[model samples]
Target: MTTASGGMTTEQLREHVATTLTRGRERTAALIEVEPDELTAQHSTLMSPLVWDYAHIGNQEELWLVRDVGGRDPVRQDIDQMYDAFLNTRASRVALPLLDPTEARDYVRTVRDKVFEVLERSPLAGRRLEEGGFAFGMVAQHEQQHAETMLATHQLRAGAAVLHAPRPPAAVVRLAPEVVVPAGEFVMGTSTEPWALDNERPAHTRNVDGFAIDTAPVTNGRWLQFLLDGGYDRPELWTTVGWAHRVQAGLTAPEFWQLDGDAWSRRAFGVLEPLVDDEPVVHVCFHEAQAYARWAGRRLPTEVEWEKAARHDPATGRSRRWPWGDEDPTAEHANLGQRHLRPAPVGAYPAGASALGVHQLAGDVWEWCDSGFTPHPGFEVFPYEEYSKVFFGGDYAVLRGGSFGTDEVAARGTFRNWDHPVRRQIFTGLRTARDLTAAERG
Candidate 1:
């Protein structure tokens, strides 16, 4: 589909936008209300205060939808500077004279009201921004992205587990360890996906050699073996920068992990829980994933390889919009949104598995790839430069797939996520791949 409003008439488009925007707003409000006032006020260096995100989301909506598209006046011109994410760092945002929670809600509500009016009268089928309601989809996705960010902030906060959900029911899964993605040319990016970020535009063909990818992500039990074997102490196994970072951080295990005598446990959201042996190990940084890959005699899949594994169908010799097919995600498919506070067991989502039988390729944890953040052949900056252009550099490692904290609207197959290799605060992990060599076949 070219856009979320695809196959819809003007009124249907407006209703779709209204529904999506409401989902995002409700989640944002819920997140703000979930935490204690003091916790929401305090800023973590890793994230903006909840209040900042609450208002920043509104500022973005007003800027793009109301002011930019609707040609309306600003809702709160004075607060623009305060909520401008590019203008303020996470550390300083907390110090801003932000609106209280009640006021923030009012501000967003007012912006939304104006937006609905604009949607009602404005033409929905002219220009790139309005054609197929691109702007509306963009804004809703942006808001949902912030809602996921706010959800991450909630996870980073220290408190009781305010977010709750039922455990993912265990499914009968294929225990096969690896699946071979046949070597071939496959499309890597998207031009038809309307809300796809600029970085994922200009879909291009990527040629990858035959390789075997693990059926499931590395599990807590497997990572425990790495720890037992002095994975952190073996400087030789790590890149120079990674080794130095490991030393500087005095790291023995993943963040939120504790090694008490011979036992292992991790802080999930707010409570201490025994690490589930089958769940994909979350909070692993790229460097850690890399080191573990080396230990396993494999390597993190390149972004191209990851996409092929997730989107390409060797049988049909074509690409799919999502791993399971063009269909959007459903609760039966993957663990997503804020519906679950943590990842399900590694082999839990059989229906969500890729065409090649690569499990957990959609959601559970953000899988770290070996590629850095860079644009495709004809990448264009859309909406603004800060969204993707500013972050184009080797400083960031791309992570594919969404996490438990990811909102469904923001977690498409072509969705691109990147972070510093050493960042362990987000829901992150990796699935290792190795080339299928002739010697192995012989």
Candidate 2:
């Protein structure tokens, strides 16, 4: 095997690939520790059955690693079409003949067993996909993404709670209301990250005007204030399309939330709990976030401004891989990997703060940005175009930072996630930003 760049020897690359894939499997397994019926049942039209996701993760692995990279025949040629995401929409998937929970477990284990053999023998060099174990890395990230999706499904599931984790650490320090990001250029996206997806590629420079961003994400307490002030009742706070969506959906508050007499309670993973005032609010769509921002005399930061706050370090004038630094994430850095069932309270994870003193930029709730989903300056289609290319358009709103359910492998500084502006099913929240005043800019 040829020596790989980035100082990763062939052995280290192989180990990393194995570890990444393993973490994904572990999370997927934990999420599906439910009844067989639940595994096959559709929790919501917005997501797939847990069992379908179970085998689909393996099918993708087989297609990319075992067949495409290793030059092997299909393991289950007949089942490929059923698992193709584009071939069948989520709403139609439940009607298809999907593998049973037992069958899915066996098939995925069989495919994974073969995949490891391929990983051990295949050279980690040559073709772009093989170099640095990109295929394996991609597969690992794919599975982790689905794992996060499954976690969201869990949240949507109704019943006694089946998933649990210890609470996230308490707030370590008091945070300022907002941080001033100076006017200047900061690197955006990634040119060096080995596993970065296509949308995060071709690092470029962006010069943004001075702006003030919330030091932490907007919290339940603040959202309560918005509610009390009749923020949703006021149509002027919403955009044309946003107002329409709000009216059609009757969106008076974030999803899963209900007024419990005089207090607000939200359902999470089948458990009902009173609103935690200090926790960053989740299950809010871009419209609600935008409306809330408007009510607060602010707006969501553009993707450029959000990236600059999360990545730019004025002291060194370089963008690190994460808000904290180049180091991989740990328990102390962020509340990731389903470590907590919900977002930690605001001001938590001070260690995860960006160089600009923006707290919780890596994990908690995905922070909605003002920008629509768009390609960077030099975007290119990778291994496949379906991953990102198909989603490029103004219909989607860009969300930065990873949610608590997101895995470290799939969540990073340059990692860009977008969904329809009306989507609130996945864990999402926002922080507000505004242009610096003339005096403040000076």
What's the TM-score of every candidate structure? 0.96, 0.98
lDDT for 155 in candidate 2 is 89
TM-score of 2: 0.98
Q: After superposition, how far is residue 423 of candidate 2 from its true place, in Å?
A: 0.7
Q: Give the CA lDDT, 0 to 100, for residue 105 in model 2.
A: 90
Worst 10 residues of 1 by lDDT: 34-43
lDDT (C-alpha, whole model) for all candidates: 0.84, 0.91
TM-score of 1: 0.96
| CA error at residue 268 for candidate 1, angstroms | 1.3
For model 2, residues 351-378, the per-residue Cα lDDT tens digits are 8899999999988899899898989999
lDDT of 1 at 129: 82
Model 2 weakest lDDT span, ten residues long = 1-10
RMSD of each: 1.7, 1.8
